[model samples]
Target chain A: MLALELGPVKGSAVLPTSSASGENAFRALFAAHYPFIWRQMRRLGVPESAVDDATQEVFIVAARRMSDIQPGAERSFLFGVARRVAADARRTRHARASAVSEPLGADTADEREDPEQALQGRRSQAMLHRVLDAMADDTREAFVLFELEELSRREIAELLGIPEGTAASRLRRAREEFMEIAGRMKATASRGAP
Target chain B: MKRLKDELPEESFEASLLAADAGGEPPEGPRRRALDAALRVVALGGGSALVAGKAAAAATAGAAATGGGGAAGATGAALAGWKILAVVAIVGGAAVGGAVAVTRTTDVAPSESATSSPSAPVPLARPEPAPPDTQSAAPPPMLAAPAPAPIHVDTPKVAVPSVPSTVPSSAPVFDLAGEVRAIDRARAALAGRDTGETLAALDDYDRRYPAGSLAREAAVLRVEALALRGDHAEAARRAQELLAASPEGPYRARLRKVIDGAAASSP
Candidate 1:
């Protein structure tokens, strides 16, 4: 249940035609979407180590189907491919380990006098990931697109092929769940428990 | 902690944390590697051999295809070796006479030899961005052909007609891809120290693209081939002619290297 951020492609709308134009257009597409795809793959539950491979897998699929993708729909097309790639990687990792190890745990209490200072940067990110990992896949996906990526509700609905109202409801549920869990975590950190 | 009050919206409450989470750009190393891999796979006609650790090979092949970035010493050498076969592919497909076909042949052929063979006898000699002087360089004296027909790569009427094999005799439309392949072959042949073959390839390029856009690249390769072939006097003369034309040309550094090499190697 990873999140996707499928921002609209900007400027160029050059579709693949001849080999030269096709290759050049592909380069433009790659430059525009590489970062978004990389972050999306990470949030989609792909482990850090396998993120590069998963990202490459998504583009490889894109390259093969470049001619078939409609010009304005490239972003959504790539997100769909990224979603499938993340799922495959997650399944593979799940099979390899009896219990999937959480990448960064937020349970360790900081020795620093200021608890808020301890959770500012990397720890904050880790806590976010933990909360994301705890939620149901669908809710997390909607939450991620809206809350983290700042993609509009309409975009998320189009990306997920769901009605706009459905996307809104899902985001609401995800927000409440996120707040409840984050509150509990904040309380635990303040208590200074190991 | 007050930021997370019961009434506060989740978006506003976590704005700081979300910014921390998503603010950074993706790591350049993985982005580069992933791009290199995608370019290689595409060049390979979407082959699934996308091996994880083959970044080095993919990087060279990627650079070659896109004409972007510099290849490392070893990869540059390998690219040089493949240049010979790349030229041969061009010569074989010479009758096709369009940039699209030439690009396809050049990219696919060189990539095949990209991995197993990693070095060649000749050193660096790549086509740089065409300077204004080079871009407007006159057609070669040897070409009896009329001025090149203007390429309409985007025109629906002439945009890669189905039968590429029949198009050349009527009108030779040279584009960047064809020019690149021609230069790559000449450069490769010269790198392999087969100056004779290099000159032959250049001659073919001249004939095919009399008013070629990459005349400057061809000129540079021709001079280098002559210098490497022990034709120091002719090489020096041609290099001087090029230098005199555009003293501040993009190929100035490369031409100086050629002159220095010619001077050092002459008896």
Candidate 2:
């Protein structure tokens, strides 16, 4: 069997030895935080399809700089890597968009429904989706990390490489924008009613 | 609004997150290709370096011997010894390297065969007719003088039948080395206590062989590997996934043990 023989290094516990052992320890740490790192990438707006490759790239960086990462801060380190990867992807997308002609929105058509309750549910979901879509990127990220992912503000700040206050402010802005969009959606629905 | 949130379901979000993170079953092609490429490069570089180093030393010794004619014979013998040492080193290194490469290639094991034989046919007995009433059948001819005592023989020449070679073998004929390698990698991940590598390796195995018999054991090991790496929640979730998928799987007991262990160890 062609196994990745880890010559002599042992467990996931961090050793006080040279950087080589530290790298192994960090590789171990990176494995533990993989899900979170990937989640951060997705929540930060990297498409689901691209998240794995981006996540792999993130870990490659992590692996390369494994020795430099501080103990107990591995989570932050991974989140930071995820944030950068997400930004890079967004930038690439933006560059492509600039180069190519604008394309029609390709959102899938809503499934056919006739019942009033089902219609109302669809309307609600649509309203929420629109509200989420309209928010600024940073605000959306903060809100998702905080409300959806249930990460603490401190963690969010660390992940975004911003101050804790900024994270809180972003969340507040995101919530307000969501409320406004929802209000508009509700007004439009009422106006359309018999 | 409350109903809408309830209908959306927290579990759905969790599922989406997991799906998003899982990306898909890993790309086996790329990983294997990359590993192969790396090994090739290493082998080539090592080979070149060995050759170059030997050539350089040989040239230096040759020059030294040429500059000292008085000690030429002794130098020539020493040079021959150096050449032998160099050849030994290069040959030994290459052999070891080849062995390592072969050991690294994960492949399948061989299978076994089957067949068996038949027995003799039995003679059926015919029904005897009732004694004729008309003429007493000439009194049965007095048994015809006992039929010459029926020349008895000692042993019957029974035909020992050979087994037919047409049946298919039921033995599994896949790469045991690959499975063992995968298990070893998982074990290494577990030893590192890295939840990520362990989960990734498990996921890789599962993706590559969804219906593999050893999948359940790998899943159980994944849970342990994750837990050892200090990711209790993910370990618990994975355990739940395993239990839900195959409650009666071979590794169910081990899965439960890992789950219990994780729970106990969780903060």
Candidate 3:
């Protein structure tokens, strides 16, 4: 069994489940993938307003399909769910396509890091989110998993359900697009500067 | 086309690639509430598509029954139910209009049909935070009548009276969920480090739900705000006091960290 640290949510307000072991497995699954799923939903362009619900929808879908999930396939499975959720979200509010993913709240966190670092981190995150949001869907998905998450091409291929060659091609396209968007972003930033 | 790829140093690009990921950080209060609400729904067997539908049958019926209560021909509940699994996913989040939605100007053209054209790239900055709307309950009435409401998941109120379908106007807005929204807004304020806004929001929260579920979260944030504003003595005192008050509190670690930080930073 993989040791997934559930952190604060291990026992926080656990709603009762029928099977003890099943609930344990579900919690383990939640522990393992909640953040990843949240991030993936944002990457796939679920607006922040709807992101919380979208993330929950993914998990609820997972809960309903819990039996179908293999042990190691959690993230990929969540990715698939995230994609569907994001698509629905975008369709519902195409205007929200330009929404910003808010920085994680610092209220509950350790503030050991300097406030300046935190601010810079937020800025970098904003830049990154913009660049990724501009890429075509397939390329963005592949690039996010492969480049940011550092999944192997074969792993990304498996996750995205494409041939490895297709995954590689998407990554290539994604990388070039990412750089182009990054360049444009930098140019845009420079232009906006007084 | 300026070869943006040419600008990326191999090693630097490798590092910066992951810089954007930031995947899997533990969620804070509002998000945690969302996750918890989802777990409650799923744990209650609302996870199945079939159950999600049955679970949302009332909301759907409420929408269909009412002519204008729902959006774009979609009632808030029905749209939420079918598209989002309803509050089974959005229970707590829905009440908090547009979970801090920040609209940024789009720099990239809608079409990525051609990559890397030398269109003068417009770098958009981060969106300014939403102006605090202390009294407004619904996200400033969406321009389009049918716009989907933000999902907010709260445990269903067993005691709240449900109006008949034909009379959808009688249904209450369920202000109980506002407590969560107040907490969420306070945190949003806290994130921007506006101590006054944070305090005022928390004060509003206190007035709204004196013995609310998120009191502890509010307290913790209050301490953080104090310290952030350089009231180290007050922050440390309050944190240590809160810690002593709830030695085994859920925020024990977080509280200790704040207390320690305040002490260390004291002049």
DockQ of each: 0.06, 0.01, 0.06
- The candidates, ranked best first by TM-score, are 1, 3, 2
Q: What TM-score, to 2 decimals, does candidate 3 have?
A: 0.42
Worst-scoring 10-residue span by lDDT in model 2 chain A: A1-10
Residue A44 local lDDT, model 1: 73
What does candidate 1's lDDT look like per residue over A59-177, in tens digits?
75565444323233445557777776666566656665547553323344545323466456666776676677667778877877777666667667655656779988888898888
Instruction: Give me the runs in candidate 3 sitting further than 4 Å from their true place.
Output: A1-18, A70-72, A96-119, B1-7, B10-21, B28-35, B46-267
Which candidate has the highest TM-score of all? 1
Tens digits of per-residue lDDT for model 3, A125-193: 655666676688888888777666666676666566566788887888887788777666554443442
Which regions in candidate 2 have their CA more than 4 angstroms from the true location?
A: A1-23, A97-134, A161-163, A181-194, B1-267
**Model 1 interface CAPRI class:** incorrect
**Whole-model lDDT, candidate 1?**
0.49
lDDT of each: 0.49, 0.39, 0.46
- Output the worst ten-in-a-row residue range by lDDT, candidate 2 chain B: B111-120
The DockQ-based CAPRI class assigned to model 3 is incorrect
- As a whole number from 0 to 100, the lDDT of residue B42 in candidate 2 is 19
- Candidate 3 on B164-261: residue-level lDDT in tens? 11112221111223444565556556545567987898898777655543455567667767766777788778888877766644345555666777
